[model samples]
Target: MKIALNGRPLTDQTKAAIQALLGELARRGAEVQINDAYGQTLQEWGVMHPFTSLYTSRADLFDADFVFSIGGDGTLLETVTHVGERRLPIVGVNTGRLGFLATIKPEEIAQTLDWLENGNYSLDERVLLHVENDRDVFEGTNFGLNDFVVTKTDRSSMIVVHTWLDGEFLNSYWADGLVISTPTGSTGYCLSVGGPVVLPRTNNFIIAPISPHNLNVRPIVVNDSSRIEVRVESRSKNCLISLDSRSKVVDDSIRFTVRKEKFGAQLVKVKGDTFLETLRSKLNWGLDIRN
Candidate 1:
């Protein structure tokens, strides 16, 4: 089995964990192809690895079988972008807090790798949001596995986002920002802004406002197939638009539209692990205070 590894900067904190991962993969005879950035980090740290090759550009991932995302959820999100429309199955190794998305633990590395080798896993196909703008915002990598956000830049006053669903006019939101999150991302920014926890496989998009001026305005769930359009009217000359972790400041005059990408992300989940299990564990649902 061939695995492509990509992650954030390496630190002394995560060194042992990574070493164990490399040693185990080498022991199991699984081919490891690491990203250039991560490869450089490993070399700089004098961490011995068994990586067969280094891949830099996303196009270079053609020969990879599985994309292993190391670090945190942020790294996994970036890996999703790099995977693009190839639909490669991704396994995330969490080395950060919260870990709402990166579910793998360091302690379970050996067991998890064994399961991966023996084909004891399922794929969780996650919907991706594709952003369209006048001048190709985010350029080639304009899709995200999570939510799309339009927020005010810095301390700029609240922005008014005129929203439309399937070409029909929706309400104009007067708030700090707006978040159109996928069901997979319902627990992220959407949850922080009072959105409901939606099932990951649900074919819907949750439109949630960030601190809306009108208390009555509530987050709404829309069909994933529906087209979403927004025109921003902010006091500041420029506002921020983001696809998951990637954010850029653009002129408020830019009109934006969001839609489901043609191809989705495939997250590899080992058997016995379910989304409900993760959700309940992460959210601490049904836990008694006295327990």
Candidate 2:
């Protein structure tokens, strides 16, 4: 088996767990590849080994059977960009707080590897949002596994986002910003702004306002197939646009559209894990102190 490893900067607490996982993979004769950035970090920490292949670009991940995303949910999202349209299955290891996407724990690394070797895992396909504009916004990849956000720039007052769905006028949102989230992202920024949590397979998009002037305005769900067009008018000359973790400043005159991507991200689901279970555990869904 061939595996690609990618992640953010590792902390002292996670170093030992990573070393143990790597050692076990080596003992099992599985080929391991590490992203160049992570490889450099490991080398600086005196943990780089002879068995690991280092790669700097997505082209180097062509032969990987699976990609291991270490760190938190944000790290897993970054992994999706590397996987791109190839639809490579990613196994997320949580070494950060509130890991909604990176559900696997460091203690479960060995067990998870056993399941993978024994063919006891399934793939969860997650829809991605693609951003379109007259000119390049996000260079190279314009798709995000979580959401696309439009907000006012710093020191700017609230912006007006004229939104349309499938060419039909939706509403002119007067707020700090707007969020267009995929079902997979319902638990993220959208949820913070009162968006309903839709099941991952629901094939829906959430349009949630951020600090709307009208308290009665609520988040609305739309079919994933619907095209969402947004034109921003801000007091400042520019506004901020973010696709997942990447953010950029754009002119208020720029108009952009978002739609569901043709291909989705594939997440590896090990046996005994379910989304409902994760929700209950991570969010403390049914827990009550008064009980």
Candidate 3:
């Protein structure tokens, strides 16, 4: 089996885990490839392996059967850029705080790999958002597994976001920002702002305001099939637009539309692991404080 590895900067703890994982893979005779940037980081840390290939671009990962994302959820999100439309299955290893997407811990690596090798895993298809704008933005890869955020820039006051669903008027949100999240992202920024936690297969999108001026304004859930159009009015000429972890400054005049992407992100899930289990562990759900 051919596997690809990608990650952000690693700490000592993560490096040790990665080393162990690589050693196990080598012993099993699996062909391994590392993202070029991550390979350089490994070399800097004096962790070199003769059996691994280093790939510099997305095309280099085309032949990979699976891509292991090491680090936090942000690292996994970055891996999406490399996978693009390839729909590669990603296994996220948690080495950072609040790893909602990167569910597997370092201690579980060996067991997880064993399951992966024996075909004891399933693919969880997570929906992605395809962003459209009047001008070129976010390069050509405009799909995101999480939410798309539009907000005011630093030093600027709260902006007004005029929203529409399927060309019908929604509302003018007077707030710090707005979040349009997929069901997969409902647990993320959407939840922080009081949005409902949606199940993965809900086929819905969440519209939540960030610090809305009106106290009565509440988050709303909409059908994923609906096309969302947004226009921003900010005192500052620019606004901040972010897709998952990537962000850029854009003119307030830029019209934006978001819809469900044609393809979804494929997440690897081994048997006995469930989303509810992750929620309980990560969010301390059902913890008995009185105990």
* C-alpha lDDT (0 to 100) for residue 175 of candidate 3: 96
Candidate lDDT (C-alpha), each: 0.90, 0.91, 0.90
Clashes of 1: 0
**Model 1 C-alpha lDDT per residue in residues 165-277, reported as the tens digit of each score:** 99999999999999999999998999999999899888999999999999999999999998999999988778888899999999999999999999999999986678899
Cα lDDT tens digits for candidate 3, 1-291: 788999888788778988888887787788989998998888898775554678887876757788999999999988988898899999998988889999988999889988998999999999999999978688887989889999899755889999999999999999999999999899999999999999899899999999999989999999999999999999987899999988999999999999999989999998766888888888898889775
TM-score of 3: 0.96
Which regions of candidate 1 are displaced past 4 Å? 289-291
Per-residue lDDT over 1-291 for candidate 2, one digit per residue giving the tens place of the 0 to 100 score: 898999888789988888887888888888888898988888787774544678887777757888999999999999999999988899999999999999999999999999998999999999999999988888878999999999998755889999999999999999999999999999999999999999999989999999999999999999999999999998887899999999999999999999999999999999777899899999998898875
Query: Please, what is the TM-score per model?
Result: 0.97, 0.97, 0.96
User: Candidate 3 at 78: error in angstroms?
Assistant: 0.9
lDDT of 1 at 21: 90
Candidate 3 lDDT score at position 260 = 96
Clashing pairs in 1: none
Q: What is the lDDT of residue 180 in candidate 3?
A: 99
